[model samples]
Target: MRVAVVQVGYGDAEPVPERVERVAALVRAQAGHDLVVLPELWAPGGFAYREWQDRAEPVDGPVGQAMSAAARDAGVVLHAGSIIERPGGGEVGPDGHGLWNTSLVYGPDGGLLAAYRKVHRFGFGAGEPKLLDAGEDVVVVDLPLRDGGSVRAGLSTCYDLRFPELYRRQVDAGATLFVVPAAWPAARVRHWTLLAHARAVEDQCVVVACNTAGTHAGTEMGGHSQVVSAAGEALAMAGADEQVLSVDVDLDAVAAWREQFPVLRDRRL
Candidate 1:
């Protein structure tokens, strides 16, 4: 499967509306790619905590609509990064906050394929934990390939990479491809790449990690967006700047690697 990982870079000076339009255009540019992935919270900004509340929208809000159209125009399965979701009807989380850091995927026909609310909130007591609800369910969706076949993709966000159990559960659910969107900071960028390789090696799944770039709200985003094979091979990796890493991934290799290694079957835990 051909994939395009768009590593987006934005700053505080750029308005959210212009950024949204820019990202949508970027998605539209990857016309022949089977899958196009974006970074986490690229719309509302990752460390722009103060802006999230004002930028929050529903599932089918402006960001979603723009992504849907972009996917349709590009004819690719688009992982349209993430958005700050404030659903209507006054729905609130256990913490009394109705906001959610939600990721969205769209089909070639501009249809909503899947939406995964980030389960592990990054901040311990402040940012996410204090302002957004933790997602309770794990999301796995079937992604279409160019060969008229499909691959089961497990969805997780930035901080979710630290927890192995979440991916273990996804592996149990028959996921072979792991889609991870991150806005990891430059300070711990090493951890970001290392953890991605670890997840792919351990789970024996294709890891498509899209991360953000540039400084925003005083935090520099780590921009090494990458794609790792089931065998932990870094097929493609971008730099610490805005880039689009396009590479072809063999989905069939997952099963072959699992059969060859058979490590997962020996797990006793």
Candidate 2:
């Protein structure tokens, strides 16, 4: 399938509404691609901890509505990065609210395909852990292919990259492609690249990793959006900036590599 990885760049100067508008336009621009992916929390600013609550919105909020329309307009499956989700319910946290770092997906017809609440929060005791509820289930969805049929894809957010078992579970569930939307910082970009390839090699699936660019809350984002094949090859990569990368993902290669290597079957633990 043809994929577009949008490495968005922004700073504290950019307002949330304007950022949402810009991102929606970017998604709409990828009409020819089968799937379009964005980086995490571009609207609310991933590292801008203080602004999360004020900018937080429900699943059908402004950004979500705009993206759904863009997906329909473009006729492509869209992974609209992530949002600071203010989950609707009576369940309240210590701060008298509940939230989640939620990833949203829209199908070609502009319908909600999947919503993955980030399983792992970045901050240990503070930040996300203090405010947001952790997601329990692993998420995978079927996306259309270039020729016909669909490909099973696994979804995970930024910090979850450190955990191999998450990808392993998705592989066990028959996922052949993995989509990771991150707001990774510049300091650990090497780890970001390393872990992406590691997950692709270990799970024998195509890994699509899209990261943020520019700066947010004084922290510089690592902008190296990349697509790694099942054979651990970098099909395409983007530099540290706000740009979109288009690459064709070969689903058949997953089966071929797995059959030739058969590494997953040898799992002992």
Q: Please report the candidate that would top lDDT against the real structure.
A: 1
Question: Can you write out model 1's per-residue Cα lDDT over 93-158, one digit (the tens) per residue?
Answer: 777789999999999999999999999999989888988998889999999877799889999999
Instruction: Count backbone clashes in candidate 2.
Output: 0
Candidate models: Cα lDDT each: 0.95, 0.91
Best by TM-score: 1
TM-score of each: 0.99, 0.96
Segments of candidate 2 deviating more than 4 angstroms: 91-97
Give the range where candidate 1 is weakest over 10 consecutive residues by summed lDDT.
Answer: 90-99
Instruction: Give the per-residue lDDT of model 2 (tens digit) for 1-269.
Output: 89999999999888788888888888888998999999989889889899887988889999889999999999999999999888666555444548889999999888999999899988888877876888878998998754678989999999999999999899988999999999999999999999999999989999999999998788999999999999899999889988889998878889999999999899998
> What's the CA error at residue 262 for candidate 1, in Å?
0.3
Counted clashes in each candidate structure: 0, 0
- Candidate 2 minimal-lDDT segment of 10 residues: 88-97
